[model samples]
Target: MGRKWHGQFEGEVVTDHAEYPLRGRLPGCRIKHRMKRNWLKMYDKAGWILRVETVINDPEEFRVRRRVRRRGRRRTEWVPLRKSVAYLFRYRDVSLQSNAQYLNALAQVEDPTAGLRGLDTITTRKRSTKALNPVARPDCQLFTALMSGEYAVHGFANRDLRSKLAATVVRLNDDPRRQSAQVSRLLHRLHVYGLVAKIPRSRRWRVTAFGQRIMSTSVKLRQWQFPANWPSCMTPSKLVRKNRRPNEGRSYAPFSGGPSTSPLRLVTPAIACATNSKLL
Candidate 1:
């Protein structure tokens, strides 16, 4: 009997023998051998003729072929499956908590907001009942200029404010002399919005605490883009009671009366007559 050889290819076992393929015959081809020890015959499912035949050769020297169907026609071709370099170097999968811990540790290596300051106190105007949030476009621009310290000092004129914001924003016209009208409109809107106040009869304006909050927070948001993962050092300032002192410019007195011990009373407005109206 010829020497029998056994080996594996891509986890599949194969067998071969010596002197398997005769001259002018392919490897693994079935043929009547002189020793008759290297022939294998497999009958077809219909059992009419032999379909699969193998001749013993080198087990590791086998070729693989696949049947591919295209346009309703079938064809046989050789296709080899092999491992890639990236697959050999890939790392094992990690757990969710492990990944999160790694990211948390990586974040602690540096602080992005170490020197940044928190937002200032935000309060609505004393006599104004409108919500102070969502500042308007012109108001936001004017407030940013006012809070930049230079314009905030000694209060700034419409021209000086325009000069400060000229290169940064495009709201002002190209002609410096013609910017007064636009600047005055923005100042009037800011006053109406209650974000800043004018000193009795002066051309200058001062930003309120509410305006500081709105402008600074808006600028910070625009600059930082409100990243998905907020840094650890971006903590806000600690809050204190504005009414702690009795002489502070508090709008209303704190409710010292205990929780209501009786049912609440409701007030209703009386309808007015059209004939008694002052502006009909």
Candidate 2:
């Protein structure tokens, strides 16, 4: 629920994976969104009660504006969610409102894309539309560049990505304005695809949770099994041992279950038969 917020968010509030440990990793909300010090935490109690609580570690986070005198000049000052019995009602109201918003948004979600179906939108190319096609050599390069580890923190700006994108897709015009414009278009496409989102009140973008997963997988697809590098392919388990240019034609053989009740099975033996020889 906390992850639904379009602001600076990190981990999912309602994930089985625990980012924050409280007496070991518990399956519940332990997100530290609003601020590092102040956050809203909700978890199950006794496997029944839904304990939703907000903690304002730093009172200054919730500011109260007031006029204060400073050197005979009246200047406005701010004061700061939960830490006093006197304002318990205020805290409860705020917490309940946030809970309502989270639940409301979650309720309205109709058939959210939680499957791999969305991958088609990124890798499929249509000449008539300006959609991204990561399957292409150039587009795949551009797609991987956006997932650079450095930009994970504080997001990235046009200047930060422009040079990277230009380096990969050198076909783009040499003009800086053109490069910047191209990068802008790429970012727009990423935003449209939900792979990235613009930081509020800033000209920067951060990869969302979904973006991290989908982009990483998409990038790996560029190197998926093709020319004898199947070990590191996306489906690593599907190994191939076929007779190729150098290997003898007898690549696989059926194991004989002579006199035994065990069922015979076909297996690829490491040792290949010599040319023009037949196994007995």
Candidate 3:
């Protein structure tokens, strides 16, 4: 008997001797009849007997298999390639380093506070003034004008109120434009704080009720008093004369001598000569 391997199948076996050909070698003679009988008995006992057919000349057979491959490992380096490239490009030449140092020195020599003084100091002062009391600050003159009856009808138009205030202050002093800018800045602050509202369809603005209250408080806090040197347009001649009759013996007119009697004279000859000359 040849060595039997696991899962190997023999040729088909026939149970009926009449179905087999009476040749020298039968087609199913190679299979072990005893093993086939035992397998059929086991199948009957397990109730798994199945009718099966084998195709001897079938086509379309294929085989499939799976395989895994290992990959090569990589090396580790302490220094990075990108850092080396950056260093090379940055320090490529001596001139570049010299120029960089020169630029740094120039930056140091330049007026560092040139731009910052106006921006930082002036801004801080303005903010401090506004915080102390918004309406009291000259910067808030636009809001002040709005609070006052000066621009009540005009409203807060595009810098119109500021221009008017500038003109007024200039008429009073000098360099009104600078004062006007300060007023505009204050008005912007008031608008940001929601104390003022812009009128729709126009550049004019107005103070809210809260603004009015703040203005009233500011007026009280500042205790504004009329300047001693304030000028007035009234003249002595235009001064109103009181319509009062002299008291009993008091005289109404300036004291002068008593009224004098004088004869009325007329130049008739000269008048007649002038009339004759005009006619001629």
Candidate 4:
């Protein structure tokens, strides 16, 4: 019964048996217009139970007898009628721990290589080959785009990523090529590898959290960089604009309220330390 109502989430009708189609397993029954009121009262009293059967008065279309008589004859016509029927519902309370196992299984299915550890030194997955590897130039680009936070809400489309790549990353020849087709194929490959998922009923793709984490780690490794201790070097309020070049003697005050220096060059700790030493 719980599975039968699951289709309601997907815009399917409750009466339709698409999700749990009726077959030879259960005996066929027609919807009845009348039900015992005593049974409904009993079910209502025990409504606090997890699983219970209740009688509901639902409207249905059917033929009904009409009082409009001609030549001493009664007539029957098709009309809508509110009828009572029996319905059984089963409920279960699901918690985060209960759903965690399913989520883990789904993640493994999405990206087979995501949970793997120590591919270079300690451990390696058996029955895996280089040919089955998914990380490539295009895949890297897609991952980077997903991590950029530009498409955080609506995801991204093929044309959107293609244009972005053409401007900054992928170089196109003077003659031009089938960029549209190439981008489509690239997106399909990413979907197959479970890096990006296509939104249902839409031509957009969103990166999974696992994909984002792996891409971020890969970028850090490639640049030989590590995560910073501080949140950011400067805030918006601290930003300053220089109208003139450094040689022109344009200066800005430091955040430490020390002597001003040229805004064009970066202020390193060593420079600040030397300045303080001289002042001392």
Candidate lDDT (C-alpha), each? 0.49, 0.63, 0.42, 0.46
lDDT of 2: 0.63
lDDT for each residue of candidate 1 in 75-179, tens digit (9 for 90 to 100): 996543223333221111112223344345546886634223222122244244333333355445645677878766677778787887776644788776678
RMSD of each: 29.6, 18.2, 47.9, 20.8
Sorted by TM-score (best first), the order is: 2, 4, 1, 3
Stretches off by above 4 angstroms in model 2 are 1-114, 123-129, 224-280
Query: How well is each residue in 138-212 modelled by candidate 2, as lDDT tens digits?
Result: 766866877898998988999988767666753666788987887888788777777899999999999888788
Off by over 4 Å in 4: 1-114, 117-139, 168-177, 226-280
Q: Candidate 4, 4: how far from true, in Å?
A: 57
Q: Say which prediction, candidate 2 or candidate 3, comes out ahead on lDDT.
A: 2
Q: Write the per-residue lDDT of candidate 4 for residues 1-280, one digit (tens) a residue.
A: 1112233343323321112223544333232112222111111112232212323333231222334555888776534433422211111111122234434444577654535642221122234322122244544555566677788888998778876777555553343357777777666655555557989999888987656666766665444442352336554323433344443323323556444662433342224455445443
Colliding pairs, model 3:
156-204, 156-205
Model 3 per-residue lDDT tens digits across residues 178-228: 656665665676665556777888767887766676565455444443232
Q: What's the distance in Å from true for residue 13, model 3?
A: 99
Local lDDT at 153 for model 1: 65
Candidate 3 — worst ten consecutive residues by lDDT sum?
55-64
Model 1 regions more than 4 Å off: 1-142, 225-280
lDDT of 3: 0.42
Q: Which candidate's TM-score is highest? A: 2
